[model samples]
Structures are given as C-alpha cells and as structure tokens.
Target: MTTAERIAAAPTGTETAGHPGPLAYPAARAAGCPFDPAPAVDHARREQPVTRATLWDGSPCWLVTRHQDVRDVLGDPRFSAEATRPGFPFLTAGLRELITSTSSSLIRMDDPEHARLRRMLTADFMVKKVEAMRPDVQRLADDLVDRMTDGRTSADLVTEFALPLPSLVICLLLGVPYEDHDFFQERSRVLLSLRSAPEEVRTSSDELFDYLVRLAESKQHEPDDGIVSRLVARGELDFEEVANMGRLLLIAGHETTANMTALSTLALLRNPAQLAKLREDPSLIKGAVEELLRYLTIVHNGVSRVATEDVTIGGQTIPAGEGVLCTINTANRDDAVFPGGDTLDVSRDARRHVAFGFGVHQCLGQPLARVELQIAVETLLRRLPGLRLDVPFEDVPFRHDMAIYGVHSLPIAW
Candidate 1:
C-alpha cells in the first residue's frame, strides 16, 4: 500500500490505537516543559512505535520512536544517509540545499569514503587525545565563570558562557582564529536556523566555505597542529574537500556543544533537587552530564536516513527508498529503557542513551563533547553556588525555530 493509503487507514482520534493518521513529523515540545519531548512523541511511542508522518516537502516518512527501534534503524546498513537522493527526507529546505550542493561531509557520506575521511580525524578525538585537553577545558570553563560572576548579580549565560567556551575550543581545534567567532557563529546560526530563507542559508554557507577554503590554502604553506593544518600537511584531500570537512567540524563541534551546555543548565536549574545532587557531590559530574545529555537530547531534529532496501523496524516493514526519522528525544525517554523516563535523575546510568546517535555514523567528537560538558557544568556550579535563573522561568527564550533545540539567551544570576 502507498504511504498515503496506510495513513488514511490507520486509526486516528484524540488518541490512537496504532500509528495515528498522518501525524506531523517534528512535533513541537510541550509548553512549560522545554526539557521533555513533545507529548505527541510519547503518544506515538506508546501507541505506534513506528508510524508514518509527512515532511515539509509532503513526503511520507517512517517516524521511529522506540529506543531499540531507533538504534535498529540507525545501525542497519540498509538505511542510507545520502541527502542527495531524490526521496531523501530533509529536516529543512535550507538544509537539503546545503547538503546536496556542498561537498559531502563525514555525516553525509556512507561507509568507505565516510570511514576514510573520518579516520583522518579519529586520533584527534580518541579518549586519550580528548583527556589531554582537560586542563585546557577546565581553564576555559573557569575563565568563563569568572567573567559571568565578576561583580555582577546577573548575566546572559548563553552569550557570556555557554556559547563562547565551546566556540573557542572548536576554534583552537580547527585552527580558526578566535576573533572570527562572532563572524562564524552568526553564519552558523543562520545556517542552522529553521527560520532562515534558502537564499540566506546559501549565502551564509558560501561565505563560510570560501573563508575555510582560504584558511585551508594558507595551512598548505604553514602547517600547524590544528585539524585543518594536519589535513593540509597530509595532502590527501583537495582544498574543497578539506574546507568542507573543516566546516562540518567547526559547526558541529561548537553548535551542539553550546546548546547542550546552555540547555542542560536550564534543565538542571528547573529541577533543583537534581541540581543539588550534582553540587553536593562533584564525583557525580560525569554521570550528571550523561543524564543531562539523555534528558535534553538537544539534537532532536538531526536523526534521519533513507532506506536503501526494505527494512522492518519495530515490526513495521519500511519499503526501499522510503525516508526514516529516529526521533532521539522520545527514544531516550523510552519507558522500557528508562523507567520514570521524563524525570531528571543525575545518578541514573544513562550510558546506553543514543544522544550521540548510533552505528558507524555516530558522532565522532562525542568524547570531546563529554569532556567539555563535564568540565563546563561542574565548574559553573562550583564557582557560582548561588546561580539561578534571573528572570521568570517562562520568560527565558527557547530556540524552537532552530534545527538544534536550546535556549537563545539564558538570563541567570549568581
């Protein structure tokens, strides 16, 4: 049966028996509960773990909500990440254009090529490599907190602390100048903003690409320890390829980490008891970071793939060429895997959460992200024991329009 036919036949009402009839994919999170997944997501998880949904382009796609089912689809070789495919489901039109038009990054490519390019940066992100940077991360965190709490009762945490810390780290790693953060961050914002027009996104993306291309070329003459420099010295990839890879690292390394830092802080502040646990025992910092990552699951809109062949996920057989979306927030909150899944429990063992996704395409920079979160969160609370939201909880601006979920500006007082 056609996707439209199946949706028409599926039961639908105020609630559903199984997959509801043509529910919208990328449902909005419930108001006043920014940390939780949309109520519709939980309904789908309970009623129909795998359901069909309509995308922006009017494509019918499988929306997988169950925990294991999400992993199954992500890990399955039959599912392809090729954004250029005709039937591939894209999160936004701007993103679709960017992915199709630009040189393929590690995330956009599959297997052989993906593995080869990813291997180039694997050692840079390995546990030991990331651990070596712990002192640097700690210093950065300390300096950020100092700036925020220095003779001020309140500050915009998003700008002052959350965003810049990660941006600087990624800048150092990618050999991009720290002074250019404002330039790239604005461009990255435009690139990831759901509200950005296709032309705006394209223009910003082109500017960033050209800048990276120039940077990559300069690295050819002056090799350094940064990622772009290393790639230049190796002479494996051409300028376009190196520029594209550097662009991917720069955006991914900062944007996701920045959101997580701010959003996780908001999540913890909302749950004072949980926040108290972390402040009381510094040893829980590592586990608390894991729990926060699982709870917030900031990259809510990113998990997507196109089926290369027919694949059965959560008892539903998706046909070849169909698009599949693994809604990470709902999957992490799966009741089967996490009882009382919505509650914030810092001590809970959340190592199994697919917040970084799963399979061969899983986030390569996860170790670095984790270390940054651990140090950033731990140091923030330790330095500012009096920290709390400066404004009404409902007043804080949330980034619902962005492809990545986070706060736009978090006002806090220490």
Candidate 2:
C-alpha cells in the first residue's frame, strides 16, 4: 500500500451507531507513545481542516496542517520564528529560551536580521563547500564502522555510529574544541528532550549556555578556521551571540541527525529490499535519505511561531500576538502535497517535501548532514550486510513525548 494509504489504513477508531470511541487523551498523553503523537493531530488537520488546540503549555493555539497552508505560513512574515509569545509549545519550557535566545542566529530571526546572519555563515554550508568536506566525512564514517567490527555484535549505533559522527562533523564545521564534544553532546541531548521534567530541562540549558560562552571566549584569540572563527572575523556578533549560535548548532545539528539515523536504520531494516536497492546503487542514497527524512519526520516537535500581525489560515483568524504552529510532521504527511504521503518510498520524489523549512530560513547544516548520512548509511550497509535488530520490535525503548523523535538506545546485533 502507498504511504497515505498505510496511514489511512492504520488503526483509527470507528464511531459506529449509538457508540462512542475512546475520549481523546490530553496533550501530555502525547508523551506516552513510542513514535510521534502526530497521527491524531494529522487526522484533525485533515478532517477538521482547521482546529483549535491546547498547547503543552496549557495555552490555546491554532495548528496548521495542509501542505500549501504550511508553506504559506512559513513564508509569511506575520508568522515569524519568535517562539516566546503566548501559546508557544509547552513540551519543554527550556525550548523557549533555546530558540528565542538565538536572536542573533539566522534561524531565529526574520527578514533583514536573519538574512544578515545567514550570509555570514553561507560559505560554510554551501553545496560546493560541503562537497569538499566529503572526503573527511567519509573517512569519519568509515573509521566509526571499522571500530564496530567483531564476530559477536551488539552495539548502540546511536552512540557508536550515529550520534558522534554528526557532532564530530558539525564541530569541525563550527571549530569547537574536540575535548569538549562529550560535554556538549550530553547537554544537547537533554535540552532536546522536551518530555523531561521542566526543572531538569532548565538546569541542563543553564549549564549548556555557560559552557558555550566559555568555548566562545577561547575562540577569541586562538581563532581556528571554523564557523565561530569565521563569525569572529566579521566582528558583527557579540560574544554572547557567538555562544548562542554555538549552542544552536550543537542542538539542531546533532539532535535531528542522530534521531533520524536510528529511525532511518529501522525504516531500512523493515524494508530490506529497498535497503538492498540503495546498496546496489549508491546514487539512490540521496533520494532515499530525503524519503526517509520526510517519511520519518524526525522533528515531531511543532515549529511554533508568533503572529507579528493578524493573519488567517484555513479560515481561522489568528489575531496579532497569537502563537501558530506549522506542524511539519502533519504537513509532510498531508495527502494534498505528497501522493501516498505516508509511505517510505525510497525512490519517491521528495523534492517538494518541507523537511527543511522553506524559503530563507531553511536548514543551513543540510549539506553537512546529507554528507554525514550518505557516508554513514552506505558504510554501515556495506560493512554489516546482515545487520539485524537485537531486541524485539516492541521492546525498543523510544522517547515518545519529546520534541525530538528518537530511541533511548538503538540496540542492534548481527
């Protein structure tokens, strides 16, 4: 069956004559599942067209779902990436500070400011620029796999393969000190887990911000040839801004890539024939990755934006100062844009998928990530052709209630 069909075919309650199905669980119950809690949300997005919902923060908000509507909202200046307004997601209070704090980074700003900051970092993530780093990325991927060798096998690929690989590459791009990688990785993971208690999340964010400032200070004199150093060259951003940028990269670059890596592996393992197709024709890897990215929808967390001005989408009026969420997971699965939108079609044309935010604020780390996944997936399949899941399918431990969709540990044995 096609993707949309699969999702449509998946279990949804039937309200038969004189009978009512289960009352819907509140948003906190969203954290109780192993995958994204988007199926219900997507159904609402599609069936009700436009609906009102309570955010995790217990504030009212409008959820946008159809692909065209999502695209329009993303491009609309009214819906800016200011996540601190009323009705922002309550999944993790720490995320408010995490996103809004980057007032200086391109991803967090709008128009001129966002453009200025993005221009500063443009050369580093350009397709040609990242292509040059292809050799280095490949070497890192190969080395990680080489160490994973042993006749008897059980390894947490997230740690041994997926997690470190991106951090190493992103650090290289940003010029972070290698010694501080573990420290940075731990805090990044905790900060991205929205399902955690608020106090713990706040504590981790405080510590991470402090750590980033120190790292930024060290870059002042002994500026290396990296992203921070390049930004330092411009002399436009203040020290705090630089540190915040570092924190942003540390969080966005590593968190999403790691989650998708584990999830993609599961996707491929479940679709062995498609995995073999990718193995035989490495060219298929790129599209396969995009397909997996769209199919997986790793950023299960909704992208919250505040309305700088009044706007209407899908017949609902969002007044000035209201918060709006463009549910990427829901939109990506919308049948309107993606025919068979829910299937994991390795060869599917995912060109229009908005896994990367559209327009000016699209993901800058995309090229680097593409290279990392390209190398990582190709190397893993080539080296461990018989790689299989060690644990029972249902036994896998995953964080269902987090902004990032990922497993606690991706346990596997061949």
Q: In candidate 2, what are the lDDT values of residues 185-273, reduced to their tens digit?
A: 77766777665555666677778777877777778888888887777667888777777777778778788888788888977887788
Q: Let me know the TM-score candidate 2 reaches against the reference structure.
A: 0.88
Cα-lDDT of candidate 2: 0.72
Error of 2 at 172 (Å): 1.2
Tens-digit per-residue lDDT, 248-299, candidate 1: 9999999999999999898989999999988999999999999999999998
- Candidate with top lDDT is 1
List the RMSD of every prediction in angstroms.
Answer: 3.5, 5.3
Error of 1 at 265 (Å): 1.0
Scanning candidate 1 in windows of ten residues, the lowest lDDT window is: 1-10
Local distance difference test, each candidate: 0.88, 0.72
